[model samples]
Target: MSDKGLHKTNQNGVSRRGFLGRTGSILGAMALAGQIAPSQAQAATAGAAAAGPIDNGAHVPALVIGTGYGGSVAALRLAQAGVDVHMIEMGMAWDTPGSDGKIFCNTTTPDYRAYWLRTKTKAPLSNFLGFPIDKAVPRYTGILDAEEMGGIIVYQGRGVGGGSLVNGGMAVTPKRANFGAVLPTVNADEMYDTYYPRANAGLGVSLIDPAWFESVDCYQFSRVGRKHAQRAGFPFVFVPDVYDWDYMKQEAAGTVPKSAVAGEILYGNNAGKKSLQQTYIAQAKATGKVTISPLHKVTSVSPASGGGYTVVIDQINTTGDTVGTKTVVADKVFFAAGSVGTSKLLVRLKATGALPNLNNEIGKGWGDNGNVMCGRANHMWDATGKVQASIPCGGIDNWDAGGAFAEVAPLPTGIETYASFYLSITKNPNRAEFSYNASTGGVELNWQTAWKAPSIAMAKTIFDKINSKEGTIYRTDLFGTNKIWGDHLTYHPLGGAVLDKATDNYGRLHGYTGLYVIDGALIPGNTSVNPFVTITALAERNIEKIIATDM
Candidate 1:
């Protein structure tokens, strides 16, 4: 569909055209300035590859390690450019339905299918009023992964879609100024003019009808959040998403299968969500030059005596046990295993002499994107509605003064929690390093849980204003035993191998010619918004350059 077709009048007589007119103009100016011709933009979505089974020891021209945003974009673009590619994902495919005929487990009734390789559920919000709300479940390879480091619990999605399978689907582009600050070496003109639009279009991003947002039962929580934010004299902006807005409207009206309205995010969305498996990965598979090996984890990568790299992989089962080991040679390798995964692999490889030429900057500049979660105890009159959607649509933007963008997150327990929850992204300068532990032969992040203090301080600037304006207080029962802040975990981990320092300008690693780092690890710490859009755009920009010159 064209951009004009995306603007339709809602039932309340509000035209989405008027709501998004300014946004459209920005995109238009970008297109004009960049001179992004029709063919170039169309080329972004031109190819579809049918994935075939991976031959155990076969050699390929390109190998992408990870199926997240970076890996998917690399695989698709490389395959479209006629470089045959193979992808390795460490998680389940997630497209198969269970015996109950559901593709995913809902948040309200989390079972063994809710977690990855864990016996007990390790929810980000693990307690209510000092009591543990988590339960034991059978250990299996599930969708959400709460990976534990020394002092932090990093939440990530462990499936073919990576974080897309379990995130709230907020597709936000960073402010232009913020983007420049986050990645100084990147050409800001190219990103804003060409790559951002290309990434957004390819991801199928859409905005909710403002009229429906005002009237829908599922968005009552967001409305309350907007009301409180505005009362505090803060800006509340609607966030675009990769979800099907029309299908969400049908879900609200009971005319279709309910996923967002039925508390089905975080665990996984059964419908209406455009995860990578449904978008980039699917398109890559249709190209006939790309293949994915789910449940296959890359263990080592070493330079081959005969010009390529030898990649050691382990095919694991549902119980987290390695069933078979295989090695393959690739002429080129791309690391897209997310920030933590890629960082761990690189740090281990460097320390263990597998790739000792990798610079000391390989494991530095790791951050949590300044994540902090808090809730407000609302008054009796401030009912947040009984039917709440798990997908968030709006946020309080106080980035200028407090350096925080507070999302009105969902409390989709299928009940009236009467609390206003938020997950704020702040500008924190704190970063940690990943070091290899020789004794245990593992990589460890030197980040402490207490390092989130700066982020908490920044987030409080926004919520404190809202609390004072609404005459409310912080909720002390959501995160832990009277813990007001959920500072022990991070949902957005970014930057380990930074762009300019660890790699050349276009994600080409300094020590290696055919190796690249194209994921969130390329960004330096934070993007001041959700990291996915920036990750996608950067991958788009880098891959275009790679295809033109390096390939």
Candidate 2:
């Protein structure tokens, strides 16, 4: 079997101890943490859930901003090392079900729970069949945040589990050969050998049952995608995902509540998918040393008068109103609020004199992960299934030849439109920077919409060839009138406070004693695939070193 095909099979589940047994004792201890099961994930809120808003002036040994992949990893490792860790999440805990008795809304039918503090939903695919699909909803602190930067709408998950709540559970690890380009300063051997397997196991990453996938009605779209890609001489590969293959099979067999098949990705999946809330965050909470405060946003982090950092937080309501303010101190701070959030905060903090000694590279390397989207109008004879799986299982590997890896995404609109949709990750060299605007007293990213041109051209290399081979054309009505590319948004926002530039090689911010960045911000730009697993693995690597030395 080839290197890329290692995760292509899950005859028995990926073992958490398989790789750790070869590594040192530190990683061996880390490997003991297991992926929370579906039933356990649903019932865990009763036990290791987030505590209510943290009290004013509380002090913690380690404070982690954001509860995403990196933050969850940091909080878990720090707590396991016997450090009292406090995680502040700017979004809701999402433990409570909504009026629909589900924690999340459906992709096709977004409600007030769809967007963060927005009166209307800001879906990625805004148009369908020459008609706009967005509709207004009551303003609430919803799951997804369509943050409008200078030239791109960064679609981020705004809840306790972070992007895990809103993304297709494609838990991918970049091929070994591409590791250097992804993080040049890091040791690839350790990552690929120790951390990647640990992350895959921790995330509960597994391959789809090939036998089941070929027979299931929900994955007929992916099968069709594979056929088209292979026909066009592209390497079609089965991608591992965090969604439970067993639960998904049950969903297909009508034995369990539907999630991926019912189009439950863009919001959140109530079943099957193993989000951070089920994996890392759940483990973090299991350590009694870790406590999370949801609906709390950190505004400032500066050196305290005596020692550590003084943190200012705002507790907000569902309507986005600031309900209370709290001041706390932390001996160490981990900035894991993702790329945009961490970069924005750090840039503003440096500019506004909160952390004046922060290095000039605070928000330097920012990129969109070369995210581009397009759909192909398949022939009526090749009818993609109406019941499409929300989680993409296959991708066309044109990254080596065309600099684009296109995931055959789903357009689960409940009817067959004969459309083959794709979300391509391209190798666009364009990088943006985030800077604080003094006039507006806000942070801004200097990313022009034109920066996506290289991405579109790279994506075209794959789709254009596939179109020619299949006698199909690009769908014009999906993004907008005559629009072939969805270049206005990015679901994978990366870089900013980049590793080896904005921070040390291991993510320690320069000029600060205990400030660290352990999130996607540490990755300069792209990771060649869905970046969560990389982020989680990097966090695991970094925190292990910190716990070994700093602690």
Candidate 3:
């Protein structure tokens, strides 16, 4: 559908075109606050339009903060249940193409669309061959956000689709046995039998073809990884993803536009990957009762004098400046801003007395999901081919015995690195807490760097044995000189307003009647796998009950 068709009036008679004159920038205010090269600015200027806007002071039946997994699910279900919903996102809509004729830049090429409002890029792989690889870029409202909080860096997606736009599309579900630890309060059978399948179907999850997997040249790195794991007496499993496998096959055959094959995972994928924008968000838009306002940040939500709640929003430009402030009323508010965003907002609200009645367990249980990265110098005979696919299709499962499940991640450096990369999701027990700092008027997460020791130890249970078997050593040049483990950052940030502790079993905040926590903030610590699938399933389960009862 064209961008103009996305701005139709909803049931509440809110015409989005009325608010277009308020700002000159259409949709997301392209080109780094209108300071980019003329040619680049021209391309972004000729791109698509924004979502149906929710005008200032317009009342909404439901207001959802952040358009990640939980928010998307909530908006869709609520709209289906006869409620007009409006979603507020802090980042851009990401529906426009740049000078490169692509909505997103490649992983290897860091452009203005890479980092979020930063003058310099903060790539996860900071160093290569003992040299720093960070570069300067124009500060803008990009998609990926590398948030530095105290001792750890949490990488989150910043646009309307949230983490789905930047993630590797690994839709992994935890084992049935490990389900007990993931959400001990929720029923295991209902989740596995009903919600899990529903979430998977809703996400369009599918496995890679085994026949093509063994023959494809793009997946040569995964083949090498599988051989190494099998030789080391570890089980090698094919983890399903949300990437369009047929489209990937077409890319391998030179029959379509390349995305995953062109090393486009870190920033965003232009094609072949099924992000939330392509799935739930699209479905919600099709419902005609859901509208979204991009570049609008929800700063405050408190009880109103009449009833419901009052929400304060800041409309920002591309350079992160608040251009206008608007206050609206919402019958109900759902906090769906990923783990960090939701936790930080709630912590500040509680401390600043905007939400005085919030329970003491608001910011208690936060964790990094035991995310750790490492690389092994494979022998020259086992060359992980120069042509590699960015979407990972396999992993090493050691969770039952060693408390770790390692994904054989892609290097996609566009060259033969001769190194085996692995990102392990271990069973680390260290949990952090977010506290409000009165001096800075900001939230601080008390997660120490030393807390990653248990994660590193658990990850070694897989790499150490494989290294001992293959007679290979750890690669010291990838992360930094003499630094073997990438323990400073976490791609999977889970928890804060933990289930049953901060909220009820169904994610309703304890003290607030019309408020809810429906995102990864409800999951405690770890999900034993890539947590998006579990996050979606839990949202499906909770929102189903919520719509059936609350609405």
Per-prediction TM-score to the true structure, in the order listed? 0.91, 0.93, 0.92
Better of 1 and 3 by TM-score: 3
Return the top candidate by lDDT: 3
Candidate 1 wrong stretches, greater than 4 Å: 1-53
Clashes by residue pair, model 3: none
Q: Write the per-residue lDDT of candidate 3 for residues 87-156, one digit (tens) a residue.
A: 9998888877777677777677778777788988787777776777777778778788889988898989
Better of 1 and 2 by lDDT: 2
Q: Where is model 3 more than 4 Å wrong at Cα?
A: 1-49
**Please, what are the lDDT tens digits per residue for candidate 2 over residues 444-494?**
989999999999999999999999999999998877789989999888889
Model 1 clash number: 10
Candidates ranked by lDDT, best first?
3, 2, 1
The CA lDDT of each predicted structure is 0.79, 0.81, 0.82
Candidate 2 clashing pairs? none
lDDT of candidate 1 over 328-396, digit per residue (tens): 999999999999999999999999998999998999999999888888989988889878877888888
